[model samples]
Target: MGIFPGFGGWINQNIQQPLKTSKRSKNGKSSSVSEEDRYIQGPWYWDPDISPKEKAESMEIDHVKSMPLSATDPRYYDLDELVRQNRLWNSEKKHPWNGAPAKVKVKTKKGLCHLNIDFTLGSPPQSVSEMFTNPRNLMYFHSMGKYKYNWRTRLDTRATKVLKKDGPRQITEVEKVLRWKILGYNGTIPIHLIIDENHQKVTATYKKVKVKHMKVFEGSWKIQPLYVDQERLCKSRSRISEEQYKKCSGGKGRIGSKVTMEHIFEPSSLLNVPPVSWFIRGIAVKVTKALLQDLREYVITYNKTETVDPLVYAKIKESIQKEKETELKELED
Candidate 1:
């Protein structure tokens, strides 16, 4: 719906997919972001380190951080547990209008706040993962709800910087500007994140860039295919086959995505007092929930709509074709 002019053309061009550079002309410019580089890295378990490194094939790494999609990597948050609680929460059959259909909770852990969110979407995990990470969809993404818990109603978000590293696995260093209001006071937050996009496993692993305002931030998003046809849980979710996915889709041609996001973070402020810290943590929880809500609503609302712009469709098609070409190249190698 061209509701927003040119889909917010005012958005910085860095947020769009960067131009591909061949081996001969690589990393020429845009190498160092002097503006954002000074912020530093946080003390999170999965901090984003863009330093040069040895290839995974030549290294004996034990952590997923070393080799994402590694079988030995810590699963971090448990999807099975979250999905169980989500079912229980929804089965109660009593919820407020804005009460998200997911199990969301936040608690103070050590000196930081830990938040875990779990929910299921109607689309397949691949589709959901692709839509959320694709830059083409970000401008069109927006939340919808009239409930009091809707904080995004007073939020303005834009991608300020994005560096897309395209390869067998896409790595992106991005920073976003979030302007929000609370208690009639306006505030702006800079969220710098390193996104490890693994479409093969349907996961986006993100770690925070330790900016001056951010003290701690690390997280991972895992989307698992649910066997919607049967009432029981899926026995295997990793790289599921097309036939099995179809059989488990409940005949609607629409699969389910068991989505979970886990993050721990703290602000770089001195509000360490009892109630002040609690209040700050509360704000963090609200912001996390609001962001997740926006994504869910965008996926559900737009996936079925026919108003998707032809240009956006073309971009997605091009992306998929390029990805397939890359996959074939790796296979041949």
Candidate 2:
């Protein structure tokens, strides 16, 4: 029933006002997540037939704006096409993936922009995946707005839910209720996404669930080994231990993952109009890049800070408690 560390911050950071930050435990340790993980809600609430109108009402949104683009517009990209030649961040010259001022990037395109945020970590792809792929990590890993007139432009996300179909046609679905505010103007966008996780490709593709509007929001996450040759060389040394790889190889080297989260965002007709359209689009792009910058900080502090992945350590304790309960039951029987 009580709030845990950092969870409320992620939920309220994007809103017009921020919530009171949650406090840590007595020893400054984070407690396990309670069941009310609205951002990571499970399939029990899934309904493939729920109309978008009904969904809007649930969020207390009175209006759903009209679409400005056609169904065939290139801006409304397919999930697999989330990464395209249009990606600005792919260029190592102009908007390099690995760069400083995380919120910075190359020029964005009209109506949409594909953001590729690439970074390396101290751990391998599997550890990075464990930190990211789990919904529980959403609470622990985020960078909130620092100042009042924060230079960072971004969408405020309220809650996220994982949806699925009951039948064979069901694929993983992710729904996010995001708040958009630019230059004192604001609106809400409810996005339903279809998630495609390809293990072999080491990528997760997300596209709009059922594209009703011309507005588009789709993206892909690519996580793969960064310094393979360095990793191989690290293992070649018998004396060098697993923990030593983070510091020993060239000082900045660790056989970590190169994570690329590419997103394509285009707003609806309500905000896509002339006067403020350009400004809003630019804000969206910057906000996304800012989010990537936040992720950089989030990942770096994962295991080393007060905020750690709840699902990982919490699961172990849960399993042990279950085993103890089973033992008590057997003895009583």
Candidate 3:
């Protein structure tokens, strides 16, 4: 039988009787709480009265002191090792997500399993003022929404106004600005999604991308510094006579005296590079009851009971020293 689309493939295959246990509570009492309530139970903000900056600083200090090592190496996440350990743990666990037993399929590849997390709440921001409350969600929305297509709004109004006073120059500058905005939106989101996938961290950034010019131009185009092209002009064919050059000064001084061209190029072009789209994505290892309690208790107790164990201590030191040396070598190179 084919598994349902939205329900994960693994969950559908493993589940024999989905409604039986889920229909009733563990103690055979009716389930009072909703599934949505479980996810929303966590504290959203850490006492808003105390500023976020101060709270984050305190948390940072606490986290640093809590970990054994000053920095935990993300590179040390061994898939095979974690899978073996997780499987062993899973065998003894009873997962809470599903009332029945749950298990994770360990693949040879590290990131083959998909962890799709989506909230039912549609398009987070209720108003412009509310945007500040949820930056991460807002950032993702902005990148995907207004920021991408809203380039004209972001342009420096003072600069655009000054250029507009010059008639023909205004048209050129406006067109250039519009082109930049369209290109900006096209590339920002897609690359950001890729970066989010790789780093396992949330970030907001304008991603520069390369793309084939379709409507705007005939071929591939790229953004570049203006001077890079302007500086390489071939030998001048028409030399203005000294009198002509001097006449350009309006008789105040020597010709061309006030014509020393210095282009303070604050110019940026959002060239139509390959288009990119952005999305909010994340991964989470579900805490489940699939594991045996005795083994689970042993692992947690082993780490907590003894502050300093010789064998474990040796292994930790060896890993840290090796890591330090590797980092040092990279720095030296």
- Winner by lDDT: 1
Q: Per-residue error at 198 for model 3, in Å?
A: 38
Q: After aligning candidate 3 to the native by TM-score, how far in Å is the CA of 302 from where it should be? A: 3.1
**Model 3 weakest 10-residue run by lDDT:** 255-264
- The local distance difference test score of each candidate is 0.48, 0.43, 0.22
Model 1 per-residue lDDT at 196: 81
Per-prediction TM-score: 0.54, 0.48, 0.14
lDDT (tens digit, per residue) of candidate 2 on 19-87? 222323567564543333343232212112224664344334211111111111111122111211112
Clashing pairs in 1: none
Where does the lowest 10-residue lDDT sum fall in candidate 1? 41-50
Which regions of candidate 2 deviate over 4 angstroms? 1-110, 130-133, 147-170, 179-188, 210-214, 228-254, 314-333
Candidate with the greatest TM-score versus the true structure: 1
Cα error of candidate 2 at position 144, Å: 4.4
Residue by residue across 155-264, what tens digits does model 3's lDDT show? 11111001111111111010111111232332211110000011111111111221122111111111111111111232223544433422443322211001001101
The CA-based lDDT of model 3 is what? 0.22
Q: Candidate 3 at 290: error in angstroms?
A: 19
- What value does the lDDT take at residue 152 in candidate 1? 40
